[model samples]
Target: MRCKSLDFIFDYFQQIPTMELEEITFSGWTAIEEKNLHAGEKPKDEKVYTMYHGTFLKYVQHIITSGFQRSRDGMLGSGVYVSRNIDKAKCYPLNADKKEAVVLKLKVRVGKVKKIDIDNHPLQKSWHQNGYDSCWVPPNCGFTAIKSGREEDCVWDPARIVVVDVACCLDDKTRWDLRKQIRGMNNHGAKDGCSQCHQNTSNTGSHPIQSCWTCTKQICPFQKKHVCNK
Candidate 1:
């Protein structure tokens, strides 16, 4: 597909008054049985379920990876979903409750090619390295940047991210309850204590052990110290 500038894409989405839910096949892991499946195991099949739960809009589906066969290429067209049922997650604390299977809505966009000024290309070096060929910008978490091009030839642009509310699924009371629960969790904080280190102490010295940002768990200080010293 021809690459459009972020401003152009944003303008295109802005013209879309109503966003429609187009059911797309998604293949990925689920919280059904085995928490962690082997590489050869087939991924679970799921579809996008879009709905508006009062104030919050939800788009639940199995996680899906970008079609890129290689990992070195970085994440492109990957869809990420935040699970509501944290207990079922393999990485989450085992003692947590496993009740509802909910996930947060995600927004994704495909990368496209955009022509750049030959003299003032952003990715001029990359372009030269790739036999002075046309550059491609891979999609990231938010925006897309040209890949395999001279730095001066390519540029990153912010596109208009379209977030749609298909329809209302949860009632007012239920939505309010969920909102309250999420707020409470955010205010209180998540579970802590690193599984690897099991150290619950705070940073003592100048070079203290770093904690996992997600779970607020402290890593092994001794291990970090050894690595740094080496």
Candidate 2:
């Protein structure tokens, strides 16, 4: 059978008895910050920013490529995109240069994830949103910690986590289609106010295929009255 979107793949995997998948749900925030640069003799503030739609695609690619890792000091961990509605997404530095910044909801699944504690020996206290805790997860591992009495308990919920593994889940065609859809969305030229129908043209200024119309229809349910230009 053919799968059209990542959501379909996620649903299909959820029902497999032998696969033994565990779902992890969370939200992640990223921002397109404007930096003042001092270049050459003439130093001027350069506006460096990315489109919200493009950033969203990159965020998804990061999750697919890097997998998820445990957060440390409330920073530097991979996350996935989970929300179907772009409007409800979260973004950091709320006051970004462009209003197009966004936050993404992520739903991820892994066969297993190992949780460990680093509060031994001299007893170092680790800080997290929950509180002072020493729980840490290894690279390529997913974990969540809850305080229990005097100590924090940690365990390996699963053996490992893998994304887009052809031997296990997702065929080549489906993966290709997924990547193409993301790239097409990133390259689409309708960055201004939303239009009823978006004309997706190629870099060479030619209509390759009516791919954007189909993409907008299938992927952009959040868009208001947006259609693909045939």
Candidate 3:
């Protein structure tokens, strides 16, 4: 299937299985200050700084398990995108409902950094090629796309980033709605075989395909290796 948007795939995968609400333990996890940095400030060289990564709730468990993956293309090509500003992290997965949004607190080791404040910087997307470990975009620097007027950063390597914690960025009512949806999914799955597996009975003993959001076919497309291109 066409990749379309990351959020689109995540929308359908919301019923893959409920997220384990229990606290997760991360190895070698180090805590950093939760405060925000000034608009034009850069992280201390070769030192760890606190950062945030915004994403939908459905993908949280997967990310925590698999770790951050580098983006194939971005303002700073081939990097794991993050921001020191929590508000900026709260603005991601833009096309989806905010109720499913979450901000991941992280500890990042920005080995060497560069600034790309200009619209036409020679290495706007190629800073990694010049031995830079990260790129910084200052707020209100004439980048029309950053409506939040917030600072953003792109780390070249995902290994340099470690997930510290996850925070839900929703109001009480929205959180209620989220819990309701999850409970509904769980209840429905209990009654209807499996949502994700549909009729693919091979793995029924392990985890039945509860109700697949994709289609009603006996086998899920995803099980056949059909999935989002991106």
Best candidate according to lDDT? 3
How does model 2 score by TM-score?
0.20
Clashing pairs in 3: 194-209, 194-210, 194-211, 195-209, 195-210, 195-211, 195-212, 196-209, 196-210, 197-209
Count clashes in each candidate, considering only residues at least 3 apart in sequence or on different chains: 23, 6, 10
Cα error, candidate 1, residue 69 (Å): 19
- Compute each candidate's TM-score over C-alphas: 0.19, 0.20, 0.58
Candidate 1 whole-model C-alpha lDDT, 0 to 1: 0.28
User: Which of the two candidates, 2 or 3, achieves a greater lDDT against the reference?
Assistant: 3
**Candidate 1 global TM-score:** 0.19
**What do the candidate models score in CA lDDT, each in turn?**
0.28, 0.29, 0.68
**Best candidate according to TM-score:** 3
Give candidate 1 misplaced runs (Cα > 4 Å).
1-76, 81-169, 193-230
Expressed as tens digits, the lDDT of each residue in 1-230 for candidate 3 is: 65779778888898588777986542221234435456478676677788888988887655554457788997667888888888888888787798778777777878898988878789989999998999888888887657777988999877677565654556766555544544443344333234553221222333433333344333343242333222
Looking at model 1, which ten-residue stretch has the lowest summed lDDT? 62-71
Question: TM-score of predicted model 3?
Answer: 0.58
Runs of candidate 3 with Cα error greater than 4 angstroms are: 1-36, 169-230
